[model samples]
Target: MHDASCRAGLARHGIMISLKRRIADRFHTSRLARSSVVVLLVMLLCLATWATDRRSLHLQLLTYAGSLGFIANSVPVVLLFFMVLVVSRRVIFTSLIVSALMGAVYRINAIKLETLQQPIAFSDVYFLRQVNASVIHLLSHYLSARIFLFAVVSLVILGGMYFWERPLLNLKRLSRIVSALLLALVAFGLYRGVSPARKLYDRNVLRIAPWAPAASELHAGLLGTLVYQAIESSTALREPVDNAAITRLARLEVPDAGAPSPVASQKPDIIVIQSESYFDPSTLAGIDDTSRLLPVLARARLAGSVGQMRVPTFGGGTLRTEFETLTSVPLAAFPKIEFPYLQIHDKTMPSLVRVLKTQGYLAYAVHPNDANFWNRERTFQSMGFDAFYSRKDFPADAPEDGWAIADSSFTEKMEQLLDRESRPVFIMGISMEGHGPYLENPVLDKAMRDSIPVPSTWPENAAKEYRNYAYHIHHADHELGRLWDYLERRKRPYILVFYGDHLPGFSKVYTAAGGFDDHQPASTQMVPWVMVSNLGLKMPGQPIYSWMTGGTILCSFAGQGNDYYAMIQKAQRHQAERRMASLDRETLEGIESLSRLYLRGEAMPGNVKESARQSFCAATGVTNP
Candidate 1:
């Protein structure tokens, strides 16, 4: 009887195992299961829109009931998922691909925020088509090694999924064709605002701030803000030129100071060095002595017009400063252009290079980074530069400090160019040595780094970052002094303009150590600039904008300028007197309109008719010079 009871119990256990296997098989093959998986992924993607940015998910949802923002955020992901699903015929595989793509974007956004103090802009998307060795090198400097690991892991997981999971859909050829066509129609409809989602996004019903990307991403959702920006960029780039405003700007009186032209006897070789991420650390709160780090700069400042100079961008976007300095056109004028070089496409734009070239001065640009990084190869030509020497142009054996080419090596190249030049040369040398992710720099040894001081109360990361930044700038300073001395010894009169493109992106340092003594936030913080000449050129040490640099250099060396540059000089004087209140709205709009026209390869300021000029002046209630 005991043997029979044991046999019955064993049979019951076998029956239960068979039932569990059947259930598992059904779950794996069921269409409902695949649908459910897709649904869960969509939900998670929506959550990540705010979660990845470390913002309050509850706050984002509370803005509206069941927030249209969530729906807006899901549209692109859903579209992508559907498209991939159609191609892969496997729901799980499609979801993995979609998630990986989105995850990469989120990671990049996070890095940009940390390093640039700004979120990724629509212009950054252009990098997709611009993949090259130079771009990869730049990514290496800015991005982490973990991204490659993530990619590898993702690929391995995807391979497993592809092999383990069978195709979920088996459609006939006609059905597949129909589905693909339908999806194409839907995508086109959404882009053209036929869908309510597109219309709402275009109107920005959530009022996502265009300028403040971080806050906008948090409030509206990252994907939603990105879609909104895409819509806006599409329309903004197509807007008609404001001919009236351009006319007014072109006709504005430009006061001439009647200063003697330094070129009366001979034209000076003008050298403008735009240092990357350059600033004096002593300007920050709780930091006083930068003499050890920037000894040459300290002494040179005493001899030149050295002061804080306002630039358009904060941490990155070096070309914005470059553009303003070259064109004497404030970036504020082109409000829609984030990366001006990529956005503004013209064959020959008005520039200091053109002005110098007109006077028989040979214009050249040298940057030991990718010439194509900021579309410099194209934009430099458009800006009227006769020649541009980029990364490929530099010596393959050039010395490097950290990941960037050393400033010393860059200075040596400039010296070579100067030595080879027979005519007056306008050399715009942009340095890359001081470019950052300062925490990982190992170029400076312990003893050298120890010499650069930070506040004791600062975090280890902040102190290390500050030390790395100081190390780079110290080398830059040495080169600056070397360049100044080299020019002085040449005995040929020369004008030397040195300035920071923007302050170093030391987000960690700023967070721990605070900002300037005046309590200016990071966005408003100014970088130092100095202009000196062997010809006794002198100007007040007041703050000026990067836009003023070109005009100042032009007027100082030539003592005469075109109408646009003369207007810039006048505005610089006003800026000095009024500080932040310099250019009013009308003036700014006029300047912007003129800048746009100039970028379109139109005539410069003086081409307008006398009658129209007088009318514009009279109507605007401004005196004619």
Candidate 2:
């Protein structure tokens, strides 16, 4: 028993020695190990700096080396982390794992921001919260190879970190605290001392490249760009509207007794359809099967007006156009508003619906999606619709092939509403059947898919997407015919205003099919708008339309005049672009000043301020008001 105990003691001592050696190696204060960790951090940071800009490797390397002084920027934060390492006496693996993970996230986001051509502005974080599959798909095209690239680089970085995990045993608490504080001061002080950062602020570099954020980011390093955006967030520079300018605009227009939403004399039944991402397929090149694209629209094209509708947002943000057409206010004039519904909650506006109500029409809105998307429920009420019909109100069996109500069913709903109405109806329908994620588009069946011919040179993905979009577009066109045919036979005279909200987000497919010019931005492309009227409703001046002009167009059919309608008529007569480049700064200032006054709680009507409803009713010769 004594001999067994002695052997056990010996084994225990041997295990203790081995454990001590392992701990000593991992937690040693070796000068070389400490220096290696510092070097690794420096290298990783330099790499991150280069990744922030999409520049050639040689130029990026030079930039990295040149900005070595900025290494001080991260040192204090890193030291604070290392101090925690000291307190816990954790293995160097702990420090390396944490730092490297942080570095990977930071660098990856920087790359994405650079690719987006926008800095991490204040709204960007907010946008993240709203991200859905569509947003991911939109970003995926730009980052085709980035995921693989990031994984490879991160693997290499972590591999190196794993080998260099070493602790700083002699790093005393006082010494660590002082070093961290001093390093923080040095970083801030040196950053402040630099003239480059100061110059970025002095010049307002961000404003110089308002459309191209990447240019500003390239000029200013990531940190500098961040600072600039932060400052701008807290204090956005708003162009002041001159009060004197408002009076000058008033002088420019003589009160016309006639113009309806800008000039309607007849109270015709009006139907406006805000089609989701619907466009003329023939507008793109190489669409062999466009024979089925817009048959009814082709026949109706010559009746009223047919041209492009220029919208503010692209791929998404449908409400921007909806608000513009409903109210004669240009979104470009309001820089601060993103989603107007969110901005103007519970606030009444001079909308087309409000105008129609005064004309003794039952104004109603129909959207075959959720009531709360983009907060349409509140916005529709504010716009003066009597009530809203959303997804919940749609038929339970509405979805035939996929989610949401089908366009065919939607047309059925419109017919039912009109039939059931006690008065002439002003129906505004926002269609969702054409909304996308074309990847999951219900296959038009194998037989139909086989009918469409794809270009040989086109990428597989583009071809597939176009085929799917074509299927939906076909359905939309067919349903449109049904609506038009039904309207043609109706006893009441009617006007059908049909327009696409915006071009669909098909990415490279748009260019691949030769539909859009690859050299230009997608937002610059226009969607087709056709007004088919049984009541002689027509746009008098410009063939093209903007959101702010929709109300004016509708009012013209009623022979009504309002402040906005009058302004729109002058713009159309003068063939003025929204840019107002033909006008002098003074004239433009006057125009904007008018917009500010009129848009701020001012609903459009007569030369004198009056209720929008009253002005609309009076224009229609109704003595009720």
Candidate 3:
């Protein structure tokens, strides 16, 4: 009886042991499943950072793998990748799409930034809010056949992942715990000085924007670089902030305000026109084309004064030069700041418009674009313009050039504005027609292509671009004639200021045409500026900085401008008549002082006051802005 009972117990114990084994097999991940996940991760890392630059092709993949590991050691980067996958429902399709976008932007920044002095920053994204055909015209020139290859490879990887992998419907609790612990380790690295994201960026990006732009993609990996940029941008320029600097500037003997009369008292029917990407391509040699790119401008130059306008940016960032021209503020003082409009938001920053308002002039700004672009509608008000006239205000029948309103149509709008004005007009016109991505043009572009000739010495791509650019600026030149004709017919005393914002960013073509070096130096991008005024103005014959352009205009006839412009004019050493780039160390100190006071709302020294209105800060407190 005892032996039978023992046998029953042994059988029950064996059955229990078999059940435990089945449970363990169900939970355990197979070697094939583990390998598949590893493969997917490796593929993603490769595709996200596959660089195509010939210079970078050498050992680029190996470099990217190393860089990815280093970047992933940053807590934020790891968190961002995980969150992206989570947001996409862990579907291979959506996740890969995200990876593809990040990769494409990486290449675009690497290629486009070659001609640019800086890498892709948050400010560049802000500019895209108002992209036009000009933007396309410019972007297409930078693209190569490699981009298609990237797309194909990306698609193939995505397809393979989609077919080979099952939905990550569930992860074991232990697997999730491992992920959390890994992330925690990365975060801990900050204290250990291993993955200090901000420190790494500040040390690298300055050298990168100018020298090794390809590194922006390869060094940190795409998403990793972007995450670091976000952190760096938020905290930048804090290093330069000094209360003592503002105090020292306030103490510097204020240069006798050149504008004894001010932006108001001498408001000489000011007409400032910034033609889009306006430069005389004919100035460059080897282009066999005989005619000047802008005949009207050339004729006007003969009669008036001609000089180069040294803008702060290249190819894009019109607002930078525009802001400089308007406010007489040297970008030099804020060298690290990319876009001031984005940076100085919420502040009623002083401008020529604000200063001109103090005088009896009614300032009206006109642009053939949506008023909201570059946040201009609100920003203009902050600049103190009495009114802004945008596309909505233009004549409905105004023709389009490429993607923008024709320059002639823009002048027509200016004429209409001048026609209705009862008060002295401080009218500023910004033309969109010559604005680029000059690859596509209006219906009229085709008709004029034959009329436009190219240089035999120029590359085929350059010849094509020059043709498109020449055709558009030709109309811009014609419209310049129209504006002057309209002004002359009105018989009004006008101070017409026409200047190019910057050279078009035609990198390869410009280099091939011998117009520029591969290094893309700042001096090679000089643009033309012509001032023709009935006010009997004394203009500079040589080059002047764009920031100083407005001050020279305002102070020309009357030698009168407000405290801010007057102060800037005082800083000019050689071209005292203009706001030249003469901000010597002493001048910079003064400007820096004033910049902090105005843009930052910091107070002037107790003993000193820079202007009648002590503050340029609006009632709104600046935070994110």
Candidate 4:
């Protein structure tokens, strides 16, 4: 009886195994029938490209690719893959339709490509406006070859997908293994490439270039060479860089300075305003009537110290500029690396805020946007700011836009802060009203269409949109006027250093306005740095200082009597030496060498660091700390 019962159980187990096999086989057959090799190849190519180029293989890349892919080609590869695999046939078509619709919606609302080039936040509506503008401009300009390029690229992707999907899907078993191997090889290659490239171009080639090359250009050449070589060798992706090693290299020791000096009595309330998209349109002669766009700023130039400020970047990356201004550190040193805000949280920064705090000044950083957006809160706090005001602190009546609080509202808030602070304060206010999505604001739109004159360099084709940007500038001017009026009424001595973060990213507008000449090294990166004083300090007539970073401005204004001032003078002088010595090489190379040493926590070579220290002592009329 026991033997018969065991036999029955064994038979049931065999039946279950057969059923499972049948189900799997059917599933595989169906998949094999539908998949195309060409489609799979294209998808693999795209994935490979993204995997190699992006910093990580995380969800962020997927989301970014999904978002961009949907906009560029009306397809959501991830959603499509899931729908095809899991959903019933009846629902598959419906899913695709819905995905396409949603993609279109997102595409319309996203920020324009040109706008995205800047450091501005993304918005869907803003993107739609750009699409409309691009479409219109493309039609007007009628670049058939450009259009052909777009069409051909699209067709190739789609056609490849249609024909190759089956074979690609069928190869999933083998592909998985191949992908893993390739990814590893690619990562390793990247790591190897970065080090040698940094040493070669960053330390060697760029050091020799006659003109300053953009950081992006340098990075591109390095990445391109690596990719080309890797492909030629058919090697698997390599492992990524060791984060621990990189971090260790980045650490440095702070110099020993005894007790810091007392803050200057005449420090006056220091106010630094980073104006959004502020540029001297007058620089682009024969463009729109800049007089009409910025009448107040233009007129003020005549009465005050005014000239071009050579900034480090164009279009976006405002925080980098802020970093330069606050730290008196040159951006040219670490061309490819981002500002240290993300990387160095614990490092002590010898910034103006810290210098002021030592002297009993209440330091604050004010921005209309989210304080956490770029780790601004932590960065400012680390820099020794006593307080930070973000969107949360904004008044109930503040104006609204896609970004943070409007410039007008920000101005009002700043005025209140100016009055309320008990101690002589140092305030850094960042404006946002002049930010992008220039078409949606009623005030700006009206101004562009009617009052504000578009720059002449604006393509006859893209004039309307360019005019809108000008109108935005006009609005910024009005806000400045209000601030100036309030300052004029005050009895307290204060100094305001106002400048634009960078030129806006509308190449057509810049070219039309005559600010950009393709033949000439386009340097719209040059902004207007002006010092406005209620206490009657005289600034230079020609304020053009050779490509000085922003952080040096504070020391420049404080006069040569403070430790901070002396330090800057020293640094600048040392920089001059390096520059002079590197006359045969590229200035960027020397900057990188200095930067590497600084980041590695090594003492700057020779007397560079000490000279700056001594310069500070001399300027401030105080003994060395």
Candidate 5:
């Protein structure tokens, strides 16, 4: 009886063990179970790629890892891996679709390379145009080939994971855990290294723009903070200001009363030409003297005051310069992503046109570009211009370049307007012949090139290109001569101040011509500001190199420096006064500190008056109030 009972117990135990083994094997072999493992692996890989590629993700992971121990890091990674598995397909599809759309949109808008370098804001109407194109492009470009490739690769990875899961799952999990733990330990070490300098970040670090979508906001915010901290903590990076330099700057004399007392008595007809890419190429080093790119300007300089005018920016975005010149406003601490013209279409501006109009002057603006470019038509109206003539309004005979109508033709049109208009016209002509794509224009003659002298700084190799630029300058000069001849006969008091909007971006010629060394900061911001008139209304003093922006020109000319001009001038005066009062070290330190803080978006505690501060905030769209 006992032997029979023992045999039964043994058989039952063996059967139970075999049953458990069979159940485990069946679950592993099933299609549903296999699919789940494949999906999990694919999701993990995708998560890893995202974590490594995105700046925000890397920053967050590093921060969190430093705070937590190895085990803690592993827990989040594992949890995220599983979470991604649930939404993997949706996330991948969304990303692909968005990328495709973006590519398509960029292509359709004929978005130039220069436009892409700057920030893009929501206020830009061009954004809507691009979006429309992007949708169409995505359907044509991304939905088929790109989508299929991604899907196939994903499936292959899933298949591989399914086949290998039973043997490799435990090892894969353990390896990931170990790697995360090590990374956490490393992050903690880095935190310790940077702990001592954390305060510097709080004091001096500049914040990046926060415009990413909600899904990315938290990540971008944290990442930005970390980057700021890292930069602040670096001992190698020197602050822009030092104590000794500030003292010297303060002692510098206030501009002597050389410029004529602002001409308050007479309101002359204003002919403001915001010439396109107007920097004299001859100014660059190594250009041949024979090219004579700016001979006419050189001649004019002798007759009038010609010197460097400091502009706010370089390369593209001419409208910002226009805004500065017209409104007497400084460049915003943080530049707007799009042209302010488009952003503030309906808003009023205190422009030269408006001011002249108040004096009963007929104000007009002429541009050889598309009316829609930068939304200038609406902006001009808002700025109080009585009329705006763009490409659409110009005659069909006007010569076309890649960007706009030729400067020569534009000038001719201006001449016609000057002759026809009954009122004292305040005409603003924007040139386009010298606009980029810097290729030579067939309309330009060799004699035209030879007539304009190249600057001493231009490189010899760049003579031809400089000559091309010179041709436009000579043509402009010839046109100006004609206008002056007319003004001479009419004997009307007219003021024409012409300056380059900004320097050209062509690196090879510009850098060499500007006499900038490889290590020296580029002086592309320095442009020609010439105040020329046929009437001998002499400015009071010798030529002065005042570091002034576009907007200051009109106000300075008008003998009134209210609003933005007063604020900037006052700030400069204060800095000068402080330098004179303080020790050299203290002065330098103060200036440096002011510049640093100003660049970083920090308010200058007590320096700026409340009204000026409000104006600054209003112009820049900063919510100070």
Candidate 6:
């Protein structure tokens, strides 16, 4: 009787398994069932991509209004999925592929917006080719374990779907081949904005907000905006250079163009340090102790030129500020190019390094991070640096404040370079110590971190973030004082320009701390800068843009730079004296034209170019090629 019962149970289990397999087979093989699943999956994916994130759902819905614009936004996404479907003829696998891709894009966009306060541009897609170990390590700080697990599970599900799903159609027959080709052609034409598709993006359907990617994304959808930007950037790049504006600016006389240069016998060693995420903590509310936070900056104010500096970018794009300072060209000049380093194709570009090299200075760049980051390893050489010292150049056991090498050890490396080189060296050192995601920093002892003050009303996370930022910045200040002492003790003349790249990415801390005095977010606020020297240099303190800083330093200490730099210095003086509003449309266009010409190794005007060529030839004894 027991054997009979066991046999019946086994037979029942086999019957249940047969029923499940038949159901699955019916769903997979039936045309109607597969089509319905494909449509449902496509609709869900469209909704997900349109929503992007929970925070922006309301704005996205109201901004686009489930009308023709919604169709315009979703058509491309659907066509993309369909394209995969036609190729693979597998509904589940195609949906999984599209889902994974859109998921990654949305996640990256969300992180960029949170950290940089800027939306992702179509140009940022170029970074995919740049991914390596350093990039992965840097990005790891922003990702959580939950996200990692979700990604792993997603991949496993996608793999299962690919294996289980049957092909919707067989393409071996000639009739089926012809049908697929016709459908693919139609889809491709519509996806590329053919006449019928173009009508969907009319003013009634889509409203473009120029220069505001976030607004445009709302006006259309995320994928729709990306398509729009691609069209706009391609068109913008093709526009002719503004030669008339360039000519007009070139004719303007440079202020103190004939000012006597410092005697060649006493060429100072120029050291410019672009501190990472450094800012005046006093600017934020609930922080009144400026001296404790930045004692060296306070002391430097008495001896050097101290003022606020308007950098080109905030939070993360260090290369933007670095480019502005080195090239003396405002990034506002180029609206289309987001990452200047990636877009810059010209080798042997004109920059501060090139300008100083003409004046008998050996230019070197030192950064205690990946040299390949932001394409710096290649772009630095293009900027005419004699050599670049990257993470590999530093000690393997270098101290790190967090994920970044400590400013203390970084400054020591710069000091060592100065000691080793007898030539007049122009060292551009970029620090990593003050970089963000400031949590769990091993360099800051628990006692010291706990001692750091924060707003009592702030949440635990906000307070901890503020404390971490304060601890890191405090070390930056100490290093500044250390470097200043090193420069002062040197027998030879020296010039040190120290400044912050941008404010820290402490959005939560700022919100919890309360509103700022200026009523503007930290993203748009200026950072502090000071220029000190051993030569008893005294100058009026004045706020300036990052691009103007290099030119001002050249004229104030060394001399007028190349004609291009002289024009920049003249513009700086004009802006300083309020002769013109900062970064006006005409001024931006003019500088853009001029900077383009210079980067291409071409001259501006006949006279300006002649004078510049003569000076450059005389200084370096290198005849024009």
TM-scores, each model vs. reference? 0.87, 0.70, 0.75, 0.60, 0.56, 0.86
What is candidate 1's lDDT per residue for 1-625, written digit by digit as tens? 9999999999999999999888867866787976787788767765654455444332433344256666676688788878877777877788788878888887777787788877776667665556788777777877666778878989999999988877767777788778888888887766555657567785456668876775676656777777777666654544456777766655555433444334455688999999988888777888898777788778877665576688998888899999999988777755567877877776777788988888888999999988788788998998788899888888898889867899998999899999998888999999999887788876846788777767899989888888888888888888999999999888777888899998887768888777787788877888888777766666644677788787777656553456566555555554444555346666567667766655556665454433222211100111111
Task: Order the numbered candidates by lDDT, best leading.
Answer: 6, 1, 3, 2, 4, 5
* Better structure of 2 and 5 per lDDT: 2
Instruction: Note each model's CA RMSD in angstroms.
Output: 4.9, 7.9, 9.9, 13.8, 14.0, 5.3
Worst 10 residues of 1 by lDDT: 616-625
For model 6, how does the per-residue alpha-carbon lDDT over 388-457 read when each residue is reduced to its tens digit? 9999998899888767889988999999989998888999999998888875445546777678877688
Shift of residue 475 alpha carbon in model 2, Å: 1.5
Q: Model 6 residue 568 lDDT?
A: 67
lDDT string for model 2 (1-625, tens) is 9999999999999999999988777646466776676557546644454453334222454453344223322433354455445454344554555555545545555544333222444334434554555446444544548676877886787567556644455668787677667756644543354454345443353333435545544544444444444434332324355656655544453234343342234356788888888887666666544554667667666554565677766766788888877876666666545566655544777676776777687888998877776777777888889889887888787865433468888888889998886576888899987876565566535567546667789988788877777777777878878888888787566777788888876745766776443345566677777766555544433444454455444554654545655555444433333333234455445555555555675443343232122322111221210
Q: Give the TM-score of candidate 2.
A: 0.70
lDDT tens per residue, model 3, 19-68: 88776455344656544653566456444444332223355444545444
Q: lDDT by residue for model 4 over 196-221, one digit each (tens)? A: 43343232332222133223222322
Worst 10 residues of 5 by lDDT: 616-625
Candidate 2, lDDT over the whole model? 0.60
Model 3 pairs whose backbones collide: 134-436, 134-437, 137-437, 138-437, 259-560, 259-561, 264-359, 548-579
Task: Quote the lDDT for 625 in model 2.
Answer: 9
Global lDDT for candidate 6?
0.74
lDDT of each: 0.74, 0.60, 0.62, 0.51, 0.50, 0.74
User: Candidates 2 and 6: which is better by TM-score?
Assistant: 6
Span of 10 residues, lowest total lDDT, candidate 4: 616-625
Top TM-score prediction, candidate number: 1
Q: Which regions of candidate 6 fall more than 4 Å away from where they truly are?
A: 1-37, 53-57, 60-68, 172-205, 233-240, 247-261, 579-586, 606-625
